[model samples]
Target: MRHPHPLPPPGHAEVRIVAATPEAARLIAEALRRRFAATEQRSYPAGGEGGTRLHLTVDTTHTAAAPRPWPATGEASGARRLQADEI
Candidate 1:
């Protein structure tokens, strides 16, 4: 069967994320969103067993190239560092 939303030419790709629940599928898709320029996700039922299938297209040529570096020791960013005892 033909996919309803076909990926645009060469630089784009189709990504499918399948999981036992919609929330689980979305969590993975959310992680992809942080690393690339992607389309909004579309979800569908995977099967009779209640799984979720999510689809989205990502632009390979466009990405989050410069992610912010982690603040050294948290104190550098004025955030308090959690002490091991807090855990």
Candidate 2:
């Protein structure tokens, strides 16, 4: 039989990465591979406008390495921490 909606198996997660460029989407997928057991990424056009969409299936039960923490506000990484109001 066929189902309109399907779910990933237990301990597995489906991740979709959308970015302005294919390179950006690929980079994000690579980063996720470093943290989890993930399948090779599959990419496709996002919409009428130019954009990239990458899909990956990751095994949450396994960890390749300890997850890195997001950079704190004003850190050298140049990522600004969002305040509650901004969210």
Which ten residues in a row are the worst by lDDT in model 1?
Answer: 70-79
lDDT for each residue of candidate 1 in 1-87, tens digit (9 for 90 to 100): 888965578988889999999988998898778888899999999989999999999888898555656666555533576789897
lDDT of 2 by residue, 1-87 (tens): 798759999999999999999988987898899999999899999998799999999999999889989765547633667688896
**Lowest-sum lDDT 10-residue window in model 2:** 71-80
All candidates' TM-scores? 0.67, 0.74
lDDT of each: 0.84, 0.89
Candidate 2, pairs of clashing residues: none
* Model 2 residue 74 CA deviation in Å: 4.2
The most accurate candidate by TM-score is: 2
TM-score of 2: 0.74
